[model samples]
Target: MRIHLTSVFVDDQDKALSFYTDVLGFVKKTEVPLGEDRWLTVVSPEEPEGTELLLEPSGHPAVKPYKEALVDDGIPATSFAVDDVRAEFDRLRERGVRFTQEPLEMGPVTTAVLDDTCGNLIQIAQSA
Candidate 1:
């Protein structure tokens, strides 16, 4: 089966949407109100509706700890491919995005990790 969806836990849905769409440059694909919260998803501009990145709420105790543990281990919740890691990092910095790791060469690729502003770290990578 083809991969069409993935999820990242977020403390707040609205904040996550802003960071993903406004800062990280993903496009909103779907947004539906779900009682107190909402079911939100985003997709890369290039991919459009190809894949959905679900912004799941981290209100559940089990999910909150798991997400936090992943962050503490320096593992990004998700990674986005870019044409130029350095340029993308700079552009994101200008938008007030906080980065934990600056662009660094890693063998055949260059990558950087940044805070999503919603309790998750996201990675941006480019071919070397």
Candidate 2:
């Protein structure tokens, strides 16, 4: 089988939408209200019909500590593929995105980690 959707726990949906869309360049795919929270999701503009990334709320009891531990350890919550890791890194940095790890090459792959601004570290990767 194949993946259809995945999620990143966010402190605020609106801010996450802005960062994921305006900065990271993903486009909104779906948004449905669910009481106090919405089922918000985004997809890469280049792959509109592909996998969707959900911006889930961090209101659950275990969310905060889990997210905190990931951040404290410098681990990324999710990774997105890019055509050029360095170029994407530079572009994101210009838009005020703080990166925890600069682009580093490992064999045929390159990756960089950046804070999502909504309590998660996200990575951008490229493969040769």
Candidate 3:
């Protein structure tokens, strides 16, 4: 079996949409309103039919502390593949995205972590 969909807990869906699309360069796939929240998801432009990334709301009580702990420990909530981690990091930094970790090479891979601006740390990686 293969992966289908995954999510990142967000504090604000609209802001997350803006960041994920306008800045991170993902394309919106679905948006169905569910009362005060929506089932919002996005996909990489290069893979329109691939796995979708859901921008789930962090309204649950446990989510707040869990997310906080992750942030406090400098851990990313999720990672996205990139052709070049350094290039992607530079491009994103130029757009004012705050990075917690600069691109670092580790054997066959390189990675950088950035704030999603909606209460999550995201990593961009390039693997050899």
Q: Return the TM-score for each candidate structure.
A: 0.94, 0.98, 0.98
TM-score of 1: 0.94
For model 1, residues 39-115, the per-residue Cα lDDT tens digits are 89999999896889999998888987887898899899888889999999989899898999999998999999999
Candidate 1 error regions (>4 Å): none
Q: Judged by lDDT, which candidate is best? A: 2
Candidate 3 lDDT over residue span 63-117, tens digit each: 9999999999999999999999988998999999999999999999999999999
Worst 10-residue lDDT window for candidate 1 reads: 59-68
**Per-residue error at 13 for model 1, in Å?**
0.5
Better of 1 and 3 by lDDT: 3
What is candidate 2's local distance difference test score?
0.97
Point out the higher-scoring one by lDDT: 2 or 3: 2
Deviation (Å) of 26 in candidate 3: 0.4
What RMSD does model 3 have? 0.5
How many angstroms is residue 13 displaced in model 2 relative to the true structure, after the best TM-score fit? 0.2
Q: Of the candidates numbered 1 and 3, which has the greater TM-score value?
A: 3
For model 3 the local lDDT of residue 32 reads 100
